[model samples]
Target: MKHALVFVASPDDKPAYREALLMLGRVALSRKLPPPDVLSGWESAQWIYDSVDGELRQEAAAAVAELPVDWALTPVAGRKKKLLVADMDSTIINVECLDELADFAGIKAEIAAITERAMRGDLEFEPALRERVAKLKGLATEALQKTYDERVRLNPGAATLVKTMAANGARCVLVSGGFTFFTERVAEAAGFHASRANTLLEDATALTGLVQEPILGRAAKLDALRSEARALGVSEQDALAIGDGANDLDMIKAAGFGIAYHAKPLVAAEADAKIDHMSLEAALFFQGYRRGEFVS
Candidate 1:
Protein backbone atom coordinates (compact mmCIF):
# COMPACT_ATOMS: atom_id res chain seq x y z
CA MET A 1 0.00 0.00 0.00
CA LYS A 2 1.03 3.60 -0.56
CA HIS A 3 1.58 5.56 2.67
CA ALA A 4 2.56 9.03 3.82
CA LEU A 5 5.05 9.87 6.55
CA VAL A 6 4.17 13.28 8.02
CA PHE A 7 6.49 15.40 10.15
CA VAL A 8 5.07 18.16 12.36
CA ALA A 9 6.74 20.63 14.68
CA SER A 10 5.46 23.11 17.25
CA PRO A 11 4.30 26.28 15.52
CA ASP A 12 5.85 28.34 18.31
CA ASP A 13 9.31 26.91 17.68
CA LYS A 14 11.92 29.31 16.32
CA PRO A 15 12.34 29.44 12.55
CA ALA A 16 15.85 28.10 12.80
CA TYR A 17 14.70 25.22 15.01
CA ARG A 18 11.88 24.25 12.67
CA GLU A 19 14.10 24.53 9.61
CA ALA A 20 16.88 22.45 11.15
CA LEU A 21 14.59 19.58 12.11
CA LEU A 22 12.68 19.61 8.81
CA MET A 23 16.00 19.59 7.01
CA LEU A 24 17.10 16.55 8.99
CA GLY A 25 13.77 14.87 8.21
CA ARG A 26 14.09 15.58 4.50
CA VAL A 27 17.61 14.19 4.43
CA ALA A 28 16.65 11.06 6.37
CA LEU A 29 13.52 10.31 4.33
CA SER A 30 15.05 11.17 0.93
CA ARG A 31 17.53 8.34 1.35
CA LYS A 32 14.70 5.80 1.03
CA LEU A 33 11.89 7.95 -0.39
CA PRO A 34 11.36 10.78 -2.82
CA PRO A 35 11.41 14.48 -1.91
CA PRO A 36 8.64 15.42 0.53
CA ASP A 37 5.63 17.63 -0.11
CA VAL A 38 5.87 20.53 2.34
CA LEU A 39 2.57 20.82 4.21
CA SER A 40 3.76 23.90 6.12
CA GLY A 41 6.98 25.70 5.34
CA TRP A 42 9.60 24.44 7.78
CA GLU A 43 6.89 23.21 10.10
CA SER A 44 5.25 20.18 8.45
CA ALA A 45 5.88 17.91 5.43
CA GLN A 46 4.99 14.50 4.02
CA TRP A 47 6.91 11.77 2.18
CA ILE A 48 4.85 9.25 0.26
CA TYR A 49 6.18 5.76 -0.12
CA ASP A 50 4.99 2.25 -0.92
CA SER A 51 5.19 -0.22 1.94
CA VAL A 52 3.72 -3.54 2.98
CA ASP A 53 1.50 -3.23 6.04
CA GLY A 54 3.48 -0.52 8.02
CA GLU A 55 7.08 -1.75 8.04
CA LEU A 56 8.32 1.80 7.56
CA ARG A 57 6.74 3.43 10.63
CA GLN A 58 9.43 2.06 12.93
CA GLU A 59 12.20 2.93 10.47
CA ALA A 60 10.85 6.47 10.08
CA ALA A 61 10.46 6.81 13.84
CA ALA A 62 14.08 5.80 14.40
CA ALA A 63 15.27 8.26 11.76
CA VAL A 64 13.53 11.20 13.41
CA ALA A 65 13.46 10.14 17.07
CA GLU A 66 16.42 12.33 17.98
CA LEU A 67 14.69 15.39 16.56
CA PRO A 68 11.74 17.20 18.21
CA VAL A 69 9.31 16.77 15.31
CA ASP A 70 6.25 14.52 15.69
CA TRP A 71 5.48 12.13 12.82
CA ALA A 72 2.63 9.87 11.54
CA LEU A 73 2.60 7.11 8.93
CA THR A 74 -0.78 6.58 7.25
CA PRO A 75 -2.06 5.07 4.04
CA VAL A 76 -2.56 7.57 1.25
CA ALA A 77 -6.01 6.26 0.40
CA GLY A 78 -8.85 7.71 2.50
CA ARG A 79 -6.38 9.80 4.47
CA LYS A 80 -8.87 12.59 4.87
CA LYS A 81 -11.71 11.34 7.06
CA LYS A 82 -15.29 12.64 6.85
CA LEU A 83 -15.90 12.69 10.61
CA LEU A 84 -13.98 13.81 13.69
CA VAL A 85 -14.71 12.33 17.14
CA ALA A 86 -12.61 13.71 20.00
CA ASP A 87 -12.59 13.28 23.76
CA MET A 88 -13.15 16.14 26.21
CA ASP A 89 -11.33 16.29 29.56
CA SER A 90 -7.56 16.20 29.09
CA THR A 91 -7.85 15.63 25.36
CA ILE A 92 -9.57 18.84 24.26
CA ILE A 93 -9.14 20.98 27.35
CA ASN A 94 -6.11 21.60 29.56
CA VAL A 95 -7.49 20.43 32.92
CA GLU A 96 -10.06 17.84 33.93
CA CYS A 97 -13.34 19.56 34.87
CA LEU A 98 -14.12 17.16 37.70
CA ASP A 99 -10.73 17.72 39.28
CA GLU A 100 -11.08 21.49 39.12
CA LEU A 101 -14.58 21.27 40.57
CA ALA A 102 -13.11 19.26 43.42
CA ASP A 103 -10.78 22.17 44.15
CA PHE A 104 -13.81 24.21 45.22
CA ALA A 105 -14.82 21.36 47.51
CA GLY A 106 -11.35 21.26 49.15
CA ILE A 107 -10.63 17.75 47.86
CA LYS A 108 -8.71 18.38 44.67
CA ALA A 109 -5.81 16.18 45.75
CA GLU A 110 -7.90 13.14 46.49
CA ILE A 111 -10.05 13.49 43.38
CA ALA A 112 -7.08 14.13 41.09
CA ALA A 113 -5.34 10.98 42.31
CA ILE A 114 -8.36 8.86 41.37
CA THR A 115 -8.55 10.66 38.04
CA GLU A 116 -4.97 9.71 37.26
CA ARG A 117 -5.61 6.09 38.07
CA ALA A 118 -8.75 5.98 35.94
CA MET A 119 -7.07 7.62 32.96
CA ARG A 120 -4.11 5.30 33.25
CA GLY A 121 -6.46 2.27 33.09
CA ASP A 122 -5.65 1.19 36.65
CA LEU A 123 -9.34 1.31 37.69
CA GLU A 124 -12.73 0.85 36.01
CA PHE A 125 -13.91 4.13 34.47
CA GLU A 126 -17.58 3.94 35.49
CA PRO A 127 -16.87 3.09 39.13
CA ALA A 128 -14.03 5.59 39.34
CA LEU A 129 -16.27 8.36 38.03
CA ARG A 130 -19.04 7.49 40.50
CA GLU A 131 -16.50 7.58 43.32
CA ARG A 132 -15.22 11.02 42.26
CA VAL A 133 -18.69 12.51 41.83
CA ALA A 134 -19.68 11.06 45.18
CA LYS A 135 -17.01 13.18 46.82
CA LEU A 136 -18.35 16.33 45.18
CA LYS A 137 -21.80 15.82 46.67
CA GLY A 138 -23.24 18.77 48.57
CA LEU A 139 -20.98 21.15 46.68
CA ALA A 140 -22.64 24.23 45.26
CA THR A 141 -23.45 23.92 41.57
CA GLU A 142 -21.94 27.36 41.03
CA ALA A 143 -18.51 25.77 41.28
CA LEU A 144 -19.15 24.10 37.94
CA GLN A 145 -19.39 27.44 36.22
CA LYS A 146 -16.43 28.73 38.19
CA THR A 147 -14.30 25.82 37.05
CA TYR A 148 -15.20 26.45 33.40
CA ASP A 149 -14.46 30.12 33.69
CA GLU A 150 -11.18 29.83 35.58
CA ARG A 151 -9.60 26.51 34.74
CA VAL A 152 -10.89 25.31 31.38
CA ARG A 153 -8.87 26.37 28.35
CA LEU A 154 -8.54 24.60 25.02
CA ASN A 155 -5.24 22.94 24.32
CA PRO A 156 -3.03 24.33 21.55
CA GLY A 157 -4.55 24.07 18.04
CA ALA A 158 -7.85 22.76 19.40
CA ALA A 159 -9.97 25.46 17.81
CA THR A 160 -7.92 25.41 14.65
CA LEU A 161 -8.31 21.66 14.32
CA VAL A 162 -12.06 21.72 14.85
CA LYS A 163 -12.78 24.83 12.82
CA THR A 164 -10.60 23.75 9.92
CA MET A 165 -12.20 20.34 9.73
CA ALA A 166 -15.70 21.76 10.09
CA ALA A 167 -15.07 24.33 7.39
CA ASN A 168 -14.06 21.50 5.10
CA GLY A 169 -17.44 19.73 5.70
CA ALA A 170 -16.43 17.16 8.28
CA ARG A 171 -18.88 16.53 11.13
CA CYS A 172 -17.05 17.08 14.42
CA VAL A 173 -18.37 15.75 17.73
CA LEU A 174 -17.00 16.04 21.27
CA VAL A 175 -17.71 12.93 23.34
CA SER A 176 -16.69 12.68 26.95
CA GLY A 177 -17.11 10.86 30.23
CA GLY A 178 -17.11 14.30 31.79
CA PHE A 179 -20.36 16.08 32.51
CA THR A 180 -22.48 17.69 29.80
CA PHE A 181 -22.09 21.01 31.60
CA PHE A 182 -18.52 21.25 30.34
CA THR A 183 -18.93 19.41 27.04
CA GLU A 184 -21.78 21.65 25.90
CA ARG A 185 -19.76 24.76 26.64
CA VAL A 186 -16.60 23.29 25.20
CA ALA A 187 -18.39 22.14 22.05
CA GLU A 188 -19.58 25.68 21.53
CA ALA A 189 -16.23 27.19 22.40
CA ALA A 190 -14.40 24.88 19.99
CA GLY A 191 -17.05 25.03 17.24
CA PHE A 192 -17.91 21.37 17.13
CA HIS A 193 -21.09 20.46 15.26
CA ALA A 194 -22.41 18.57 18.31
CA SER A 195 -21.40 17.12 21.67
CA ARG A 196 -22.26 14.19 23.99
CA ALA A 197 -21.46 13.53 27.63
CA ASN A 198 -22.76 12.15 30.91
CA THR A 199 -25.03 14.36 33.00
CA LEU A 200 -24.38 15.26 36.64
CA LEU A 201 -27.59 15.25 38.65
CA GLU A 202 -27.88 18.32 40.82
CA ASP A 203 -30.53 19.69 43.23
CA ALA A 204 -31.85 23.23 43.32
CA THR A 205 -28.54 24.62 44.63
CA ALA A 206 -25.98 21.82 44.96
CA LEU A 207 -24.87 18.55 43.40
CA THR A 208 -26.79 15.47 44.51
CA GLY A 209 -23.49 13.57 44.38
CA LEU A 210 -24.94 11.27 41.72
CA VAL A 211 -24.53 10.86 37.98
CA GLN A 212 -27.21 9.78 35.54
CA GLU A 213 -27.39 6.02 35.13
CA PRO A 214 -25.62 4.22 32.25
CA ILE A 215 -22.64 6.53 32.44
CA LEU A 216 -20.77 7.48 29.28
CA GLY A 217 -17.67 5.43 29.72
CA ARG A 218 -15.37 3.57 27.36
CA ALA A 219 -18.16 1.63 25.65
CA ALA A 220 -20.33 4.71 25.30
CA LYS A 221 -17.55 6.66 23.67
CA LEU A 222 -17.14 3.96 21.02
CA ASP A 223 -20.88 3.92 20.48
CA ALA A 224 -20.91 7.67 19.97
CA LEU A 225 -18.21 7.36 17.33
CA ARG A 226 -20.18 4.77 15.38
CA SER A 227 -23.53 6.51 15.74
CA GLU A 228 -22.07 9.82 14.61
CA ALA A 229 -20.52 8.15 11.61
CA ARG A 230 -23.84 6.53 10.77
CA ALA A 231 -25.59 9.89 10.91
CA LEU A 232 -23.09 11.11 8.31
CA GLY A 233 -23.91 8.08 6.13
CA VAL A 234 -20.40 6.73 6.51
CA SER A 235 -18.77 3.76 8.16
CA GLU A 236 -16.49 3.92 11.16
CA GLN A 237 -13.62 3.71 8.67
CA ASP A 238 -14.55 7.19 7.48
CA ALA A 239 -14.02 8.72 10.92
CA LEU A 240 -10.97 10.03 12.75
CA ALA A 241 -10.78 9.60 16.52
CA ILE A 242 -8.32 11.28 18.91
CA GLY A 243 -8.08 11.20 22.69
CA ASP A 244 -5.64 10.91 25.59
CA GLY A 245 -7.06 8.45 28.11
CA ALA A 246 -7.62 4.71 28.50
CA ASN A 247 -11.38 5.23 28.15
CA ASP A 248 -10.71 6.58 24.65
CA LEU A 249 -8.96 3.42 23.54
CA ASP A 250 -12.06 1.71 22.13
CA MET A 251 -13.08 4.54 19.81
CA ILE A 252 -9.46 5.26 19.01
CA LYS A 253 -9.06 1.70 17.77
CA ALA A 254 -12.41 1.67 15.97
CA ALA A 255 -11.80 4.78 13.89
CA GLY A 256 -10.18 4.61 10.47
CA PHE A 257 -7.36 6.78 11.76
CA GLY A 258 -6.79 6.69 15.51
CA ILE A 259 -4.52 9.21 17.20
CA ALA A 260 -3.21 9.55 20.72
CA TYR A 261 -2.59 13.18 21.59
CA HIS A 262 -0.07 13.22 24.43
CA ALA A 263 -1.97 10.18 25.66
CA LYS A 264 -1.64 7.75 28.53
CA PRO A 265 0.78 4.83 28.16
CA LEU A 266 -1.80 2.22 27.08
CA VAL A 267 -3.54 4.51 24.59
CA ALA A 268 -0.25 5.74 23.11
CA ALA A 269 0.92 2.18 22.65
CA GLU A 270 -2.15 1.08 20.65
CA ALA A 271 -2.90 4.14 18.55
CA ASP A 272 -2.13 4.26 14.85
CA ALA A 273 -0.20 7.50 15.41
CA LYS A 274 0.63 9.80 18.31
CA ILE A 275 1.17 13.57 18.52
CA ASP A 276 3.77 13.89 21.23
CA HIS A 277 5.73 16.87 19.96
CA MET A 278 3.19 19.00 18.10
CA SER A 279 -0.12 20.65 18.82
CA LEU A 280 -3.58 19.26 18.09
CA GLU A 281 -3.34 20.56 14.54
CA ALA A 282 -0.88 17.79 13.93
CA ALA A 283 -3.97 15.66 13.42
CA LEU A 284 -4.85 17.80 10.41
CA PHE A 285 -1.47 17.35 8.79
CA PHE A 286 -1.63 13.60 9.33
CA GLN A 287 -4.75 13.59 7.16
CA GLY A 288 -2.92 15.28 4.24
CA TYR A 289 -4.30 18.78 4.89
CA ARG A 290 -1.77 21.51 4.11
CA ARG A 291 -1.20 24.44 6.43
CA GLY A 292 -2.44 26.86 3.77
CA GLU A 293 -5.73 24.97 3.67
CA PHE A 294 -6.32 25.28 7.42
CA VAL A 295 -9.27 27.50 8.40
CA SER A 296 -7.67 28.92 11.56
Candidate 2:
Protein backbone atom coordinates (compact mmCIF):
# COMPACT_ATOMS: atom_id res chain seq x y z
CA MET A 1 0.00 0.00 0.00
CA LYS A 2 1.13 3.57 -0.58
CA HIS A 3 1.93 5.52 2.60
CA ALA A 4 3.44 8.81 3.67
CA LEU A 5 5.69 9.59 6.66
CA VAL A 6 5.66 13.17 7.92
CA PHE A 7 8.60 14.37 10.00
CA VAL A 8 8.33 17.52 12.11
CA ALA A 9 10.91 19.27 14.22
CA SER A 10 10.09 21.43 17.21
CA PRO A 11 9.23 24.83 15.77
CA ASP A 12 11.41 26.76 18.22
CA ASP A 13 14.10 24.16 18.80
CA LYS A 14 14.75 23.16 15.21
CA PRO A 15 18.20 21.65 14.97
CA ALA A 16 20.87 23.51 13.06
CA TYR A 17 22.32 20.36 11.54
CA ARG A 18 21.60 19.02 8.00
CA GLU A 19 22.02 15.22 8.06
CA ALA A 20 18.58 14.44 9.48
CA LEU A 21 16.99 14.41 6.07
CA LEU A 22 19.88 12.50 4.55
CA MET A 23 19.53 9.70 7.08
CA LEU A 24 15.77 9.62 6.55
CA GLY A 25 16.27 8.99 2.83
CA ARG A 26 18.24 5.81 3.54
CA VAL A 27 15.09 3.94 4.52
CA ALA A 28 14.12 1.32 1.94
CA LEU A 29 11.17 1.80 -0.42
CA SER A 30 11.09 5.57 0.19
CA ARG A 31 11.91 8.62 -1.89
CA LYS A 32 12.70 12.13 -0.65
CA LEU A 33 9.89 14.70 -0.88
CA PRO A 34 10.76 17.86 -2.72
CA PRO A 35 11.36 21.04 -0.72
CA PRO A 36 8.25 23.02 0.22
CA ASP A 37 6.67 24.14 -3.03
CA VAL A 38 5.46 27.45 -1.56
CA LEU A 39 8.34 28.33 0.72
CA SER A 40 12.12 28.15 0.76
CA GLY A 41 11.89 25.29 3.27
CA TRP A 42 9.73 23.63 5.91
CA GLU A 43 10.20 22.34 9.44
CA SER A 44 8.46 19.10 8.50
CA ALA A 45 8.40 16.88 5.36
CA GLN A 46 6.52 13.96 3.84
CA TRP A 47 7.84 10.86 2.07
CA ILE A 48 5.42 9.06 -0.25
CA TYR A 49 6.81 5.60 0.13
CA ASP A 50 6.03 2.23 -1.43
CA SER A 51 5.91 0.15 1.69
CA VAL A 52 6.82 -3.51 1.33
CA ASP A 53 3.75 -4.27 3.40
CA GLY A 54 1.34 -2.68 5.85
CA GLU A 55 3.42 -3.27 8.95
CA LEU A 56 6.51 -1.74 7.38
CA ARG A 57 4.88 1.66 7.48
CA GLN A 58 4.07 1.34 11.16
CA GLU A 59 7.55 0.11 11.90
CA ALA A 60 9.12 3.04 10.07
CA ALA A 61 6.94 5.54 11.90
CA ALA A 62 7.72 4.00 15.27
CA ALA A 63 11.43 4.18 14.65
CA VAL A 64 11.37 7.86 13.67
CA ALA A 65 11.79 8.99 17.29
CA GLU A 66 15.47 8.09 17.07
CA LEU A 67 15.90 10.96 14.64
CA PRO A 68 15.82 14.59 15.75
CA VAL A 69 12.14 15.01 14.87
CA ASP A 70 8.59 13.77 15.46
CA TRP A 71 6.48 11.98 12.84
CA ALA A 72 3.08 10.67 11.70
CA LEU A 73 2.23 7.88 9.22
CA THR A 74 -0.89 7.93 7.05
CA PRO A 75 -2.21 6.62 3.75
CA VAL A 76 -1.63 8.61 0.57
CA ALA A 77 -5.28 8.73 -0.43
CA GLY A 78 -7.62 11.34 1.10
CA ARG A 79 -4.81 12.75 3.16
CA LYS A 80 -6.22 16.25 3.13
CA LYS A 81 -9.44 16.18 5.11
CA LYS A 82 -12.34 18.56 4.37
CA LEU A 83 -13.19 19.64 7.90
CA LEU A 84 -11.24 20.32 11.08
CA VAL A 85 -12.94 19.94 14.50
CA ALA A 86 -10.56 20.76 17.31
CA ASP A 87 -10.32 21.23 21.06
CA MET A 88 -9.23 24.61 22.40
CA ASP A 89 -7.54 24.06 25.75
CA SER A 90 -4.11 22.52 25.56
CA THR A 91 -4.75 21.77 21.89
CA ILE A 92 -5.14 25.04 20.01
CA ILE A 93 -3.92 27.17 22.90
CA ASN A 94 -0.83 26.89 25.05
CA VAL A 95 -2.57 27.10 28.44
CA GLU A 96 -5.79 25.60 29.71
CA CYS A 97 -8.16 28.55 30.05
CA LEU A 98 -9.97 27.20 33.06
CA ASP A 99 -6.71 26.66 34.86
CA GLU A 100 -5.72 30.21 34.09
CA LEU A 101 -9.06 31.32 35.48
CA ALA A 102 -8.28 29.32 38.58
CA ASP A 103 -5.10 31.33 38.96
CA PHE A 104 -7.08 34.57 39.11
CA ALA A 105 -9.31 33.04 41.74
CA GLY A 106 -6.29 32.17 43.89
CA ILE A 107 -7.08 28.48 43.56
CA LYS A 108 -4.61 27.54 40.89
CA ALA A 109 -3.15 24.42 42.47
CA GLU A 110 -6.54 23.05 43.55
CA ILE A 111 -8.37 23.58 40.27
CA ALA A 112 -5.44 22.60 38.12
CA ALA A 113 -5.22 19.27 39.94
CA ILE A 114 -8.80 18.50 39.03
CA THR A 115 -8.14 19.65 35.48
CA GLU A 116 -5.17 17.33 35.22
CA ARG A 117 -7.23 14.42 36.46
CA ALA A 118 -10.16 15.27 34.21
CA MET A 119 -7.91 15.59 31.18
CA ARG A 120 -6.20 12.31 32.03
CA GLY A 121 -9.58 10.56 32.26
CA ASP A 122 -9.16 9.98 35.94
CA LEU A 123 -12.30 12.00 36.73
CA GLU A 124 -15.67 12.46 35.10
CA PHE A 125 -15.52 15.57 32.92
CA GLU A 126 -18.86 17.12 33.89
CA PRO A 127 -18.37 16.69 37.59
CA ALA A 128 -14.79 17.86 37.46
CA LEU A 129 -15.71 20.94 35.48
CA ARG A 130 -18.48 21.76 37.91
CA GLU A 131 -16.22 21.31 40.89
CA ARG A 132 -13.65 23.62 39.37
CA VAL A 133 -16.14 26.26 38.39
CA ALA A 134 -17.89 26.09 41.74
CA LYS A 135 -14.67 27.09 43.39
CA LEU A 136 -14.58 30.20 41.28
CA LYS A 137 -18.05 31.22 42.40
CA GLY A 138 -18.35 34.94 43.20
CA LEU A 139 -15.13 35.69 41.37
CA ALA A 140 -15.29 38.90 39.42
CA THR A 141 -16.45 38.56 35.83
CA GLU A 142 -13.66 40.67 34.46
CA ALA A 143 -11.23 37.89 35.39
CA LEU A 144 -12.26 35.98 32.28
CA GLN A 145 -11.26 38.85 30.07
CA LYS A 146 -8.09 39.32 32.04
CA THR A 147 -7.12 35.68 31.62
CA TYR A 148 -7.73 35.91 27.89
CA ASP A 149 -5.62 38.99 27.56
CA GLU A 150 -2.75 37.94 29.81
CA ARG A 151 -2.52 34.17 29.51
CA VAL A 152 -4.38 32.77 26.55
CA ARG A 153 -1.98 32.51 23.65
CA LEU A 154 -2.26 30.28 20.62
CA ASN A 155 -0.07 27.24 20.41
CA PRO A 156 2.69 27.28 17.83
CA GLY A 157 1.43 26.82 14.28
CA ALA A 158 -2.23 27.00 15.34
CA ALA A 159 -3.11 29.85 12.99
CA THR A 160 -1.09 28.35 10.18
CA LEU A 161 -3.03 25.10 10.51
CA VAL A 162 -6.48 26.72 10.57
CA LYS A 163 -5.78 29.31 7.84
CA THR A 164 -4.08 26.87 5.49
CA MET A 165 -6.91 24.41 5.87
CA ALA A 166 -9.50 27.13 5.31
CA ALA A 167 -7.62 28.42 2.27
CA ASN A 168 -7.83 24.95 0.74
CA GLY A 169 -11.64 25.18 1.10
CA ALA A 170 -11.83 23.11 4.26
CA ARG A 171 -14.19 24.30 6.97
CA CYS A 172 -12.66 24.73 10.42
CA VAL A 173 -14.63 24.58 13.63
CA LEU A 174 -13.45 25.05 17.21
CA VAL A 175 -15.45 22.67 19.40
CA SER A 176 -14.04 22.78 22.88
CA GLY A 177 -15.10 21.63 26.34
CA GLY A 178 -13.92 24.99 27.57
CA PHE A 179 -16.14 28.07 27.42
CA THR A 180 -17.70 30.24 24.73
CA PHE A 181 -16.03 33.34 26.09
CA PHE A 182 -12.61 31.99 25.16
CA THR A 183 -13.67 29.91 22.18
CA GLU A 184 -15.15 32.94 20.47
CA ARG A 185 -11.85 34.77 20.68
CA VAL A 186 -9.76 31.73 19.74
CA ALA A 187 -11.92 30.72 16.80
CA GLU A 188 -11.75 34.24 15.39
CA ALA A 189 -8.01 34.58 15.93
CA ALA A 190 -7.40 31.14 14.44
CA GLY A 191 -9.77 31.76 11.54
CA PHE A 192 -12.19 28.90 12.16
CA HIS A 193 -15.55 29.15 10.43
CA ALA A 194 -17.51 28.34 13.57
CA SER A 195 -17.14 27.77 17.32
CA ARG A 196 -19.08 25.91 20.03
CA ALA A 197 -18.45 25.58 23.74
CA ASN A 198 -20.17 25.54 27.11
CA THR A 199 -21.39 28.84 28.51
CA LEU A 200 -20.18 30.05 31.90
CA LEU A 201 -23.10 31.66 33.62
CA GLU A 202 -22.51 35.01 35.23
CA ASP A 203 -24.41 37.33 37.56
CA ALA A 204 -24.26 41.13 37.70
CA THR A 205 -20.54 41.33 38.27
CA ALA A 206 -19.40 37.85 39.22
CA LEU A 207 -19.57 34.20 38.20
CA THR A 208 -22.68 32.35 39.35
CA GLY A 209 -20.69 29.20 40.01
CA LEU A 210 -22.70 27.40 37.34
CA VAL A 211 -22.56 26.52 33.67
CA GLN A 212 -25.66 26.40 31.52
CA GLU A 213 -27.31 22.99 31.62
CA PRO A 214 -26.63 20.09 29.25
CA ILE A 215 -22.96 20.84 29.49
CA LEU A 216 -21.02 20.23 26.29
CA GLY A 217 -18.79 17.34 27.25
CA ARG A 218 -17.36 14.38 25.38
CA ALA A 219 -20.64 13.36 23.79
CA ALA A 220 -21.38 16.92 22.70
CA LYS A 221 -18.01 17.12 20.99
CA LEU A 222 -18.87 14.02 18.99
CA ASP A 223 -22.24 15.49 18.12
CA ALA A 224 -20.59 18.69 16.93
CA LEU A 225 -18.27 16.67 14.70
CA ARG A 226 -21.17 14.76 13.10
CA SER A 227 -23.35 17.85 12.78
CA GLU A 228 -20.56 19.82 11.16
CA ALA A 229 -19.73 17.00 8.76
CA ARG A 230 -23.37 16.64 7.78
CA ALA A 231 -23.74 20.35 7.21
CA LEU A 232 -20.68 20.31 4.98
CA GLY A 233 -22.17 17.41 2.95
CA VAL A 234 -19.33 15.13 3.95
CA SER A 235 -19.02 11.90 5.87
CA GLU A 236 -17.24 11.60 9.21
CA GLN A 237 -14.39 9.96 7.31
CA ASP A 238 -13.85 13.21 5.40
CA ALA A 239 -13.16 15.16 8.60
CA LEU A 240 -10.09 15.58 10.78
CA ALA A 241 -10.24 16.09 14.54
CA ILE A 242 -7.48 16.93 16.98
CA GLY A 243 -7.41 17.27 20.76
CA ASP A 244 -5.27 16.74 23.84
CA GLY A 245 -7.42 15.34 26.61
CA ALA A 246 -9.87 12.63 27.64
CA ASN A 247 -12.97 14.72 26.84
CA ASP A 248 -11.84 14.79 23.23
CA LEU A 249 -11.47 11.02 22.81
CA ASP A 250 -14.82 10.23 21.23
CA MET A 251 -14.66 12.77 18.43
CA ILE A 252 -10.97 12.10 17.98
CA LYS A 253 -11.70 8.40 17.46
CA ALA A 254 -14.69 9.10 15.23
CA ALA A 255 -12.95 11.29 12.66
CA GLY A 256 -11.28 9.94 9.53
CA PHE A 257 -7.97 11.23 10.82
CA GLY A 258 -7.90 11.93 14.57
CA ILE A 259 -4.79 13.24 16.21
CA ALA A 260 -3.70 13.66 19.81
CA TYR A 261 -1.63 16.80 19.77
CA HIS A 262 0.88 16.84 22.63
CA ALA A 263 -1.88 14.94 24.35
CA LYS A 264 -2.40 13.29 27.67
CA PRO A 265 -1.20 9.70 27.94
CA LEU A 266 -4.63 8.09 27.46
CA VAL A 267 -5.40 10.18 24.37
CA ALA A 268 -1.99 9.58 22.84
CA ALA A 269 -2.40 5.84 23.30
CA GLU A 270 -5.75 5.75 21.50
CA ALA A 271 -5.56 8.43 18.82
CA ASP A 272 -5.02 7.43 15.18
CA ALA A 273 -2.06 9.79 15.01
CA LYS A 274 -0.11 11.48 17.82
CA ILE A 275 1.92 14.70 17.67
CA ASP A 276 4.21 14.77 20.67
CA HIS A 277 7.13 16.80 19.38
CA MET A 278 5.81 19.22 16.83
CA SER A 279 3.59 22.23 16.19
CA LEU A 280 0.00 22.37 14.91
CA GLU A 281 1.29 22.68 11.35
CA ALA A 282 2.38 19.07 11.67
CA ALA A 283 -1.29 18.28 11.13
CA LEU A 284 -1.05 20.00 7.75
CA PHE A 285 1.92 17.85 6.77
CA PHE A 286 -0.01 14.81 7.90
CA GLN A 287 -2.58 15.89 5.30
CA GLY A 288 0.14 16.16 2.60
CA TYR A 289 0.41 19.96 2.55
CA ARG A 290 3.69 21.83 2.27
CA ARG A 291 4.63 24.99 4.14
CA GLY A 292 4.47 27.17 1.05
CA GLU A 293 0.85 26.19 0.64
CA PHE A 294 0.09 27.63 4.07
CA VAL A 295 -1.99 30.85 3.98
CA SER A 296 -0.19 32.60 6.85
Maximum-lDDT candidate: 1
Cα lDDT of candidate 1 equals 0.89
User: What RMSD value applies to candidate 2?
Assistant: 2.7
Question: What is the TM-score of candidate 2?
Answer: 0.91
Q: Model 1: which residue pairs collide?
A: none
Clashing pairs in 2: 38-292
Question: What C-alpha lDDT do the candidate models reach, one value each?
Answer: 0.89, 0.84
**TM-score of candidate 1 versus the correct structure, residues matched by position:** 0.94
Over 1-296, each residue of candidate 1 has an lDDT whose tens digit, in order, gives 88787788765666634664556466546556666778887678787777634346666677677777778888899889999999988889999999999999999999999999999999999999999999999999999999999999999899999999999889999999999999999999999999999999999999999999999999999999999998889999989999999999999999999999999999999999998878899999999999889887
Off by over 4 Å in 2: 10-23, 29-42, 50-52
TM-score for every candidate vs. truth?
Answer: 0.94, 0.91
Q: Lowest-lDDT window of 10 residues in candidate 1?
A: 16-25
In Å, residue 172's CA in model 2 sits off its true spot by 0.3
